[model samples]
Target chain A: MTLNPNRAAGATPLVAMKDISISFGGIRAVDHVSIDLHAGEVVGLLGHNGAGKSTLIKCLSGAYRMDSGEILIDGEKAEIHNPRDARRYNIETIYQTLALADNLDAASNLFLGRELVTPLGFVDDSRMEAETRRIMGRLNPNFRKFKVPVAALSGGQRQSVAIARAVYFNARILIMDEPTAALGPQETRMVGELIQELKRQGLGIFLISHDIHDVMDLCDRISVMKNGVLVGSEQVGDVTEDEILGMIILGKKPERAGVN
Target chain B: MSDTAEAHGAARKRSFIETLEIDTRLLGMIGAFIVLCLVFHFQTDGRFLTPRNIFTLAIQTVSVAIMATGMVFVIVTRHIDLSVGSLLALCSAVMGMMQVVVMPQMMGMGFGHPLIAPLAILSGVVVGVLIGAFNGWLIGYLTIPSFIVTLGGLLIWRNVAWYLTSGQTIGPLDPTFQLFGGINGTIGPFWSWVVGGLGTAAALWSLWSARRAKQVHGFRVKPAWAELVMGGLVAAAILGFVAIVNAYEVPAARLRRLFEARGETMPEGYTTGYGLPVSVLVLIAVAIAMTVIAKRTRFGRYIFATGGNPDAAELSGINTRLLTVKIFALLGGLCALSAVVASARLTNHANDIGTLDELRVIAAAVIGGTALSGGMGTIYGAILGAIIMQSLQSGMAMVGVDAPFQNIVVGSVLVLAVLIDIIYRKRTGGFK
Candidate 1:
């Protein structure tokens, strides 16, 4: 998905990319893609299943390094060679499976690798519990607390925990891969509310999803891509579903008509 | 009642009531302990519980129990340290050589304060750790399976241990070292009772703390009320065990009479009682420490994560390789510690220092509820399992049970533990 610079806002772009490219083996999965995520903005990357959306996001998340082009974080050129480096850049990613320890509960999942430890040098359960309660209160107040293991949590609650984990670590850019892919209507709405909360916190969210309606409802700007190329980015209010579809299929912006 | 309704009601009650039942592993160990006691008590016509007889049991069981504690950690990580027995033998041989060759040389050099015994022990630990680290590095970083690494380690270490002493017995250790393993009686057996009580209390406290933390953090905590009641019962059981062991004594007041009959002087606390073996105290301490680490530490959590899903752990930013190495090194150090204790008790070090010890140690860990596949276990359970096995060996010997029969019985117990574990996994939807 390409970023459009015409729509200026008060929030600064946390991540600015210029002509990033990544190829696996001999296949160019992502090519010459430019994306900018402003603070407190939800940018939905719209594409077909193989439209290079995931490949591009993976490069940003540091799962794969770009073959060419530069990435700037807050206008500073950043080198992200690994996931750990991406985390240091405040780029937290939530994959489709949630990538959580099923045997561990919400608190443990929230602080999986980086746990709150006590003075005695053990995993500090009390403090972790208090912190989990506070964060869940803000992001998902209705989430049940008794189920400690992630295995027992519902789809929405598990996503909430994964999101909460990234947020708790002070994530500035959240890359969500189909956060509501397997959820029911009510659960999807719950996630929608969560995305809104993150947006209010000035977090730049790059949501990659197949649901166009979800993109229209939540994203500030929608970028369509097809065949490893950026089609165009348009303000959600200005673009119709047909126009977005056309951009995805043809890799070019459709002509604007006189209709409202 | 209608047949279908009756069956449904019965199933509901069974499901509800089953939660209160003792876990199968615990049940198995306790059952084994009781049956052994009964067999020995009946066969010996109640003479097996005599103070002298009980002390014999203490010494007999210490070596296996110590090894089992270390085995618990390795097994929990879904790895096997087949080198423990080899490490044990090697360490003891080093200690023996220090006592026989090095100390005498030091004494000849006019060094009044001979440091060979202590130095030998330290060397043993270092050697064990280094070998363990080597094995750990191979298995952890190189992504080798634990069984293969430890199997290779077993051969290498056992040969080293054998070569260290020229495959011969080396003995006549310092009196101080001997006292640790020997001197089964002291201060009227009160010290043993105190140690037991303190040990049991510490176990209870740590168990409570772990469960409390799990509850607070919203971890999958066991039922609190059940845990508390179980803790109290275990504490009380220790107290009761102390009372029973004390009762088994010939009476301290009577010990003086035997001495008087022979017109000989006696040491303090010489009066007869089961009194604690230093080995037993060491065993209990190891158990408590292991439980704390496995349940409450970040390292322990990593161990579980590594076992449950290595890929997921790696993705979570855990150094799975490093964790595996640390666990193996811990196994080696623990085995060395056990070797030191065992040598102190035997008052000798030899080629057969830890003969067939692997079977007993691994058996204890397995029987204690540690999964051979890893990801679930308790140190306390491992200790209980070791104690049960040791008791069986001692009790059977006391009852004049044939050696072949004892071996068969122990083998059956091991097989039964594995079977019980299988059933548990099935019942619990394959606890991983």
Candidate 2:
């Protein structure tokens, strides 16, 4: 395992994962991987399919139990053993499919797991609806509320609802998996803007994307991986698409090694 | 503006295929209703629409409709309760046996007096709730598929009912017990009109309030006029039904007339308005209550969420197992209640009571737009579905269709309903 770079100037890392290793059937999927994310920073996790990027994130999200690792949130050591534990640490994940129930509209989805109840012992739908409108007004102004089922909503609107569900629950760390996958250019941009807004709210985002362009445009830091190993983490402004591609192809970061 | 208007007009003129593609269940239900009307219209020389037959129709639909109300909840959570029929039979048999055994014992103990009927109802409810809880625990906490659990329960509970009754009919219930199955005294249909009118008004008010809240919040709201139109149609249907029912004698009155052949005349002009059958009122209340709970409560919302996508619901932190158990328990309790009403009406709780009703209850829910795959259905729709089934049975019988033929007709109707549901789903892109 290689050492992480020093924090630049006054910017402290919001999260530092050190010596993370996980295996399946004695085969290392994430072998001694280490990464850091800063407050209000968008860090892109980039690798080819099956290059262990997802496995590493799943470990961080408590979807997979890590064999060995030390995770620090805001420089404090933390253990996340399950999704509930992750939630307690204010970590939220929005899967690529959005996972919103199509039959329930935005308000219902916004409060899907934790609904506001009235004093009368029923679901305070009115309160939920009002809260949904308020949150959506800040998140995605174009969202519609009158729809009985969300099946009628556009894909971007659906994603907005899913993101709003996580954000409304006070998530400090947002993990988005291919947020713009399968979306049109307009919807993609819409999600990109939403992600930026979340960043402005001071959330540290771990964005997993296959599109190198998306990473270059939206991410502040890019971490490249190959074959269950971390190649290098570079500032997006300092790295090129081809350089990252080389790291993915050669299983070693040439630029970091001063060999490029 | 003109171009936009023209585009909108073009969209409106899209093919029926497109409409079917958008709302498969709607088309399927409408199509089924049309087919049923056509068949009944052709069969009894149009007597199916007569007041007497319609009165009979309400009575025939009550028990199934009531049970279907709860079955909607069970089905919505992607579960089935086969023990519902058995539960009903057990409740009725217990109630019947209690009249002979438990009630006399109470009288002997000097604790009953006039409390026997109330005690009987209480016992029925407690038994139902306990059975429901047991079923829920088995399916939800034990991680058994509901079908297997309820199927085993269905056989076991029916055997219990038979064993309790010694495989004989238990009957001659207290007159107060029979009151549940009898019609309330008639008020020339005025009471039905008043109650139905109030119900419609309440519905309209809630719809208006919901829309108002949406508009005030600048949320994309359903059009006010559209809801008003739909509510108006429903209100009109209720008013029309009241008028039709008010014009006819309740089934209880008819039964009384048959009893009058032995020189006993029913009280002059006895009527229960359109509220003739207490079971009908029970069915309506159950339907409304379940609908409100499913559409308006957090737990109800969870039921749909769990049914539609269990993984997501679980991720959201819902106790999905607990919800399943609660829903199954509700179904069991409701089935027991239905059994009491129905058995009392029959004047006996036979070991064979509630037999084959499970198929009808499930069939009604499935036909009423409940998805076998879960996360889609309504209690109101289930009631409508039950009505369609009951109408077919009653209309065929009115035209002299024998029991064997009636079974064939019903079986075919159930199959047709499923076929229509499938076709509707395919047309509407329910499955991708």
Candidate 3:
């Protein structure tokens, strides 16, 4: 993939994944997919199951290594072979399953791989709990169960933990896979507001969702994929909800929204 | 929830148990252990609780107890090590050869050399680490199941030990090495109280500092009274154990023999206590070190995290495969250490050394409150579990129970322990 003309004209997108191709055995899970996001923008990746959206996003998140692809952050090629590498580039993920170690407390889950260590190299647990308490107090003031395992937490509380983990580490580019899929309507609205807040703080987000309505309401642009290929990318203002749905289902771009 | 407001309310409202923050499951395990001890004491007509009997039990428990600590880590990571006993035998055989045969006879170094003990220990531990790494590689990189890998290891290593020693006992090890076995070696009464005193001080210091640290961070701390009570109880336990072990007097005949060896005439009416066995000290060091690694280190956190949800751990940037290798390797090192104590205690390494120790070690860990399902276990619990297992066997033997019947009873106790643990955890809403 060539460099975007927009990069030469002005600012680089916060993240640019170009020509990502990955395969399992002989089957191609993601085929030559390219996607990008810019600062302060919410890019919704919409597709049905087996449309390779998750696979494509996993490559960017460093959960899966793309067979042939380059990921650029702020116009520089970033080599992320594992989640640790992705983290170093300020890329964080909230997986569809929330991906918290259920046996560990919320503070342990939050710090996780990068724990707050003491001067003598032991895990600084109390400090971590205090930090978790401080952050949760800001993010979800009602959060009081800091000592219990995340398995005992409610759906919204768990979601907030996943989000807080990303936010605490100062994520510049966030990959959220079905962040509200398991939450109630009220919790869903709360997540919608959280996404807005992240966007307001100029953090680029890639929201992978099956809901066309969520894309229409919260996304700045929509990238639809089908059968391991991208149909097209369109601005939310240009494409109606029906057009986006057609693109997801039929894997074809509606002509009206193709111009701009 | 400002500083004084929260602390004052919690201090006034919380019960003693709540303030201590002790695990209910751990308390239950300890309660069971104590009950078992009491039953054994009664059944054996009080012989089981005698100072001499308890001291002997401590030495007998050391080898398996040390191995059980490692088993806790293995089980916590959702793995089982059926090879530990065989590994111990192999380690013992290797060390025996190093000190008695290989270095002294073949390498032309005299036996009982100071270097012989250290060199033997190093060789044994290295061999264990290599084998453990091999097992871990099969499990982690090759994706072989741990149970199958270790089961195969159980057979392969036992025969390998036989091959190493030609199915003969390797013995008359270096004298320095024998000290590790608690065979005619002990710290005596004076140093025992010193260790107990230092341990008491450290325990109290940790409790105080932890409370202060919490307060400094504006986090909730236990009440002043609760902290004092906790400290007092810990200190008392430490000193009490030291006192019991120290009460076992050294025999007059053995004291006379010791004086003759040192080229001195025995004094009339002289008596002394065998304060602490070296083997027991080794086990204690292992317990403390293992506890620290489990509670305060990154490796330990990754272990629980991976055991909890492997996908989550991997996504969190932990190299779980490597972690597996490291864990098995650590257990292997512990196995070698246990071998040192076992063979040394025997005054020689026999072909049948550590035979069936696998079942005993696993039982100890399980009884000690280690969850077979993973993401849970405690070093202290496993040590106490080892004590309970040993006490059962010793108490039965004291009562003149048949050896076969003793096995039947111990086997039944293992199953009952697991069952009770499951029901307790389920009722308490603990992590299953």
Name the top TM-score candidate: 3
Runs with alpha carbons beyond 4 Å of true place in candidate 3: A1-10, B1-13
Candidate 3: which pairs clash?
none
Clashes of each: 3, 4, 0
CAPRI class of candidate 2 = acceptable
Better of 2 and 3 by DockQ: 3
lDDT of 1 by residue, B59-105 (tens): 66767777787787688777887778887888777767776777667
Question: How would the candidate models be sorted by lDDT, starting from the highest?
Answer: 3, 2, 1
lDDT of 3 by residue, B129-192 (tens): 9898889889989999999999999999989999999989898888999999974568989999
Cα lDDT of model 2 by residue, B174-281, tens digit: 666776663432334667778778877887787677677657756444444556566776788777777787777556756586558778777765555444456666
Pairs of colliding residues, candidate 1: A105-A148, B181-B345, B188-B269
Backbone clashes in model 2, listed as residue pairs = B21-B428, B185-B271, B186-B271, B186-B272
| Descending-DockQ candidate ranking | 3, 2, 1
Candidate 3 structure quality by residue, lDDT tens digits, A92-155: 9998788998889999999999999999999999999999999998888878778778887788
For model 1, the stretches where C-alpha displacement exceeds 4 angstroms are: A1-12, A17-34, A45-70, A79-82, A145-148, A222-260, B1-58, B106-114, B182-188, B197-232, B244-264, B267-270, B392-412, B429-432
Global lDDT scores for all candidate models: 0.75, 0.77, 0.88
Task: Locate the minimum summed-lDDT window of 10 residues in model 1 chain B.
Answer: B1-10
How well does candidate 3 score on lDDT at residue B200? 92
Model 3 residue B388 CA deviation (Å) reads: 1.2
lDDT of 2 at B389: 86
